[model samples]
Target: MIAIPVETDNGTPMSTKLFGNAKFFALVEPKSKDYTIIPNEGCGNGIQTANYLLEQGASSALYGFLGDGPFHVMVRGGMNVYWLGKETMPLDQAIDTALSETLVHVTTENASLYLDPGTAAGACECGCSHD
Candidate 1:
């Protein structure tokens, strides 16, 4: 399952920022196209959110932005993170895009805490160099 942070529970567009503060997350089963919205019980707590996702069987996550701590925790916990940029599209569309592999796959080798497209131009803090 993949989790996409959303601003509302009724299939509204996903939030463009503040993954830790999102009100809801749409859990999607890619193969079956089944989805459900769950309250973000870990709101404001990145680690808690990561753990919650893992507990709920999420193997990956799609978000517009994520903090350094939570990103690291999620990656370490075996969840792949995909960046959806700043676009605010419906959760279902996001899911479809992810399934199609159109999102930027955030990895420790290339991830930056900041989302500025022109600013991610150096060795990642996780110690991987792009050179």
Candidate 2:
């Protein structure tokens, strides 16, 4: 399953809140269009969220913006990561687009090219704060 962090279970457009702050994660079965929303127990920590998704059977994740910590954790855990197109893409449309394989495939080497440590003021980038 591919996990897409979202604002809610009924969210149309996926969440743009960045990986660590998403309120929920929708685990979608790409071909079946079947999905389930799970509340993010790790809403303030990117690494925790990434690990949580992995434990929930998500082999991949579609994300717009994320921090280095989560990006590393996701890829290190053997999960495929894709850069989500359009921050406002609808949940259903995103699922379809993901299967097409057009989205930029993210890997450890290219993670810095697309990710930020954090965008908040005074945010730490060393991944030392565990964000």
Candidate 3:
């Protein structure tokens, strides 16, 4: 299954929020176009979302942004994550784009390019609570 982090409860549109900051996740089956939106347990905790997605049985993800913490956690857990670069598209198009493999596959070596420093490693400049 593919996990797409979304902001709306309906899960129709994708979120610009960093992966772990999304309010909900749309778990979809690319082939059947079936999806379910579930509350994100990790919420604003960047690193925790990695395991959360895994527990949800997400094998891959397509997100607008990611942080180094979750990047490493997801990668090490054997999940493939793609960077959808500035594309705040709807869930359907996002899934299509991912299926087309048009987005860049993120890796530790180049994670910084797509990683949101503010949210990376649970580092928040806004003095927010993550715990």
Candidate 4:
């Protein structure tokens, strides 16, 4: 299963909203996992978030427009990226579209982290840092 590290206004996962302006850094296979959210930093930029995921054993990411810096780091780290969805769709449907291949032009950008048997630094330093 895909582990999505979403940015939330509330302290709830189902209630949480994926930070629209936030940069998604990693798409992790839930099986190999450990993570931390860096707190009080606005939503994480694509690069920092991505790096955090890399530190946490992520091999891929599913998100939208990424700036050059974060885009580059993801490539260097070996993460597979597929850009999809508009702000209109809810997160679950968006993810579903991606899986079903019904989504088009969703992946405006693409990159990879290139690491094998990825490693995670635990959420303490990354995702959990946000709390």
| Candidate topping TM-score | 2
Clashing pairs in 3: none
Measured by lDDT, the strongest candidate is 2
Q: Which runs in model 3 stand beyond 4 Å of their true positions?
A: 118-131
TM-score of each: 0.81, 0.86, 0.83, 0.49
Off by over 4 Å in 4: 1-42, 102-131
**How many clashes (backbone N, Cα, C below 3 Å) per candidate?**
0, 0, 0, 30
Return the candidate ranking by lDDT, descending: 2, 3, 1, 4
lDDT of 4: 0.41
Candidate 1 regions exceeding 4 Å error are: 11-16, 113-131
Least accurate stretch of 10 residues (summed lDDT) in model 3? 122-131
For each candidate, the alpha-carbon lDDT, in order, equals: 0.74, 0.78, 0.76, 0.41
Q: Write the per-residue lDDT of candidate 4 for residues 1-131, one digit (tens) a residue.
A: 33244443234322122322453322423443433333323354444555665676656555543444444555567765545532434444544555665433212242222111111431122222221
Per residue, candidate 1 scores C-alpha lDDT tens digits across 5-39 of 88888635555455766778888989997888999
Candidate 3 residue-wise lDDT, 1-131, digit = tens: 99888878762566555687888888988888788988989887767777899999999987776656677778888999888766577877877887887888888777767766344454533333422
Error of 3 at 11 (Å): 7.2
Output the better candidate (2/4) by TM-score.
2
